[model samples]
Target: MPTILMRYRAAALLGAAVIIAPLSVAAFSAHNVAAAAPTLSASPNTGGSFAPIVSADKPAVVTVTTVIKAENAGDEEASPFRGNSPFDEQFRQFFQDQGIPMPDQSPEPRQGQRAEALGSGFVVSADGYIVTNNHVIDKASGITVTLDDGTQLPAKLVGADPKNDLAVLKIKPSKPLATVGWGDSDALRVGDQVLAIGNPFGIGTTVTSGIVSARGRDLNSGPYDDFIQIDAPINHGNSGGPLVDAQGKVVGIDTAIYSPNGGSVGVGFAIPSDQARKVVATLMKDGSIEHGFIGVQIQPVTADIADAIGLGQPEGALVAGVNGGTPAAKAGLKAGDVINAFGGSPVKSPRDLSRMVADLSPGTSKSLSVWRTGQSRDVPITIGRNTGDQQ
Candidate 1:
């Protein structure tokens, strides 16, 4: 699979790159009128403060440290350094600058070298159930959860949904632990104030304030790419942290940041709580997630392609190809068919169709509306269980 540049710094890339172009709509001419800018009677922060919210919710957040045994330690293809060495690039550059032909040196085998990674997570239940990013503990030999009071407890992986970069963990706490409730992320609007709590760069818990910069952001991470884009100062170790709203409810889970320097640049992405809540519930019940699949390669319907296909507007998923023996091929779906709707819900883009299809249950029959040869038709398909290989 082609590597996607946008990824969770704490974990591996989830999926391939999906290019979704924004549709531009033309506006009709109307009578022009002057409007006045709205004004507030008082400042926007007249009665707003994040101190109380942070003080109450910080305890539920925890630092997650993962240890990978030496045997499992290896260099990632995307990483410039070899064997996770911090000075690999500097040493090579120094030798090159000195005009010295340095001989190739193999890394010395260490007996018990361990790679440690730090991330953040929040308690979702009082009985020691915690929610964190799947990348945080990926391939970890040992996992530990450190509470706000400096108490550390061994944690076991309950379930992980790599498709959504979410994981559920279980720990045997001496007593009931503090937990945070999920909030309605659908209600969050752009410019709404949000607070981020996490452990950045392995430091202690930190709080930062920012606004919801955008909604439904897709960094081509996975089929489920409905991310809440915020300007919070989340860094490398902030993965799996909670993005709380004014009421101190977990509206989003900090997952990835857009940075070239491996640091926060005021552009961070989070998994919405509504989606996280559904996945967490299933993970708690089932050991893994079973995604619904209808094998077909799809792309966005651009304006030029829409016009060529006689579509008035650029909408729906343009089917580029269909795999054999799959639900789409079995349902007689063709290459040129544009999926306008699935299971009675409209698909505005390829990502929307992908998300809708994956959310369905396997073995269930769904009515798919498609645009074929300048006309529309319905095709019924039996959803199939995704074995983690198909798109």
Candidate 2:
């Protein structure tokens, strides 16, 4: 077996042994000698740590169910075609003699609960403000927030930004709501320990532990694509719950998991709390987000292009087009100029520049340093509103 698989199996065996050993102690203690039985540790453990954290955060982790009206009877249609076996593809000519149809229809949506699809959410503020995935509550006509203690309250949509896949909801709880502190997601490194606490598969609050598998993973979810990837088991209903560190401070929101069988294969993605914080704040204050733009369409500088442009190495964004009459054009930033830095921050690629520009304030002036003709020049340009389709 592979080394990683062997290690996983060994760890699983160890966990099972630890939990089952205590039960056999009484059986052995029944002997005539009546020796003291091996006692289980009474102190807190990792698996059981979920209980304490869940108990404390349950009030903030609300069960979110979405209701949407649809016309189609929603069950997904089954595919009528079958894949060729391992050796079947080798004999395609023989099989082609027989008629076979390829699977080619769009899947039908599932039909059943038009009333609700279970998910999770977390309170971000004391004023009964909550943050959840845009999908969890999208197209929901009447949202009801069900507390951990069984209190159901009406909730209103504060604002939603589909680009980030996040939404803010408001509810008037009877008392101050429990809120989790946001941790510095930028400080998280791959292999750092992490925890995921949420309601999974409609089960009560459950917790799972794992480590940061990756960082800044771009799943093509949005323009500001910076996801903190974790190995924690985040299931269907786990979306929108907090991915906290060992300190119980939330570093990311449990957003997505990659599964072919609808079960965790140890791959999961979360929106970094730092980005979510900015989105949530903007949604709360302005009811909509306005991102900054530099009016430059850019591409990644390749080795050949870098050499042609007199760059020592291939790094930074290659400008492809500049919007007419925009700040970048007015600042003499022409096509083919490689932007190396913005506001003293290095621009690694097109996405890096896109994110940095989006995070900037519209109408604010920012400096751009570019490399051209074996020379570097810094140009100041006033940021402009991004009116085009945003990611």
Candidate 3:
């Protein structure tokens, strides 16, 4: 899994951050614009006031506070003031001269300190089923959920799937709780209006509105990288918050953001609600998810590699290696074979194949289309339960 950087940006600033990679922006001419008017008009709202939607969805959003025990608190880096830097003494003297309190010069380690973190979550069911990011309550000794009405209640972790960065929690509410319904994230399109509700920077429920900046974004975070990119200002403490559509349906879960500094850069990523719903359901039932596995190392077929392999287009996943005694090996899958399709679904890239394979049920048989020695052929393989050891 790739490291996801968490940052926050204010909701008021909507400027696009400079991405290192060049993004293709489509340009429309006057004639094309006129031709697309009808289609554009028929499409969902690309821009509008999300006040009504936010008002309805805000109540379901809750603030998640986690307390990690001292034993679980990770090591902290040495501070500059604690080191023997020449400026350290001067800094202390300057503070004293300016009538400011002197900084703590204690050499005590923080191993005894209990760490606390704040994030956001939303009620998914009236019975107090909540959805949040796994990282939010990771290694937490205690969890608490604060409702919109200022009611705080202890929560228990029902299940967590770190691979998907999602967790399901159960709370005993006094009564039926406000809940949000999941929407079909597949129906989302770029430029569609979205509302992000979360407790950013530990502040109370904050609602930010923006458009779906992009879709099917893969930030190299995990095997399931189908993230919905939104310009909605989500910052630190917003993780696990719901990204609601214009109709107040939960379309995605705010997870990570791209930022050079520790703030949002108008580029935030969310786990699509459609994918999350399945995980949440499984977690609620089994308390964990078991991913299907086919033992094979794969890589994306680059244009140069594709040409060399006689493939006209850069597509599918190229098998780099095969694990012995595994399903792929038993099924006659070999290195250099390009997997074009799995279970009748076209594999667009290595990540696509990874996600498809992981979603399969273990011990199930599936047909795979492979390109080998300049020809395509179908091979049947039985999916195996992931042992949590394979990369």
Count steric clashes of candidate 2. 4
Best by TM-score: 1
Q: What lDDT, from 0 to 1, does candidate 2 have? A: 0.63
Cα displacement (Å) at residue 340, model 3:
1.4
Off by over 4 Å in 1: 1-48, 75-112
Off by over 4 Å in 3: 1-48, 75-109, 303-313, 389-391
Can you write out model 1's per-residue Cα lDDT over 293-344, one digit (the tens) per residue? 9999999999999999999889999999999999999999999999999989
At residue 56, give the lDDT of candidate 3: 65
The full ranking of all candidates by lDDT, starting with the best, is: 1, 3, 2
Please, what are the lDDT tens digits per residue for candidate 2 over residues 1-391? 1432243233222210000000000011111212222221122235646555545545567766454443211321111111211112322332244443222222333444233444578766655677787656655666666676667778888887766767777788767666666677889999988778776655566678999999987644336777787898876567678887665667888876644444577877788887787777777666777778877778889999987878987989998988788878888998889998999999888888888888776888989999877899998988888776331
Off by over 4 Å in 2: 1-52, 71-115, 323-327, 388-391
Where's the lowest-lDDT run of ten residues in candidate 1? 17-26
Assess the local accuracy of residue 281 in candidate 3 as a C-alpha lDDT between 0 and 100. 78
TM value for model 3 = 0.76
lDDT of 1 at 333: 94
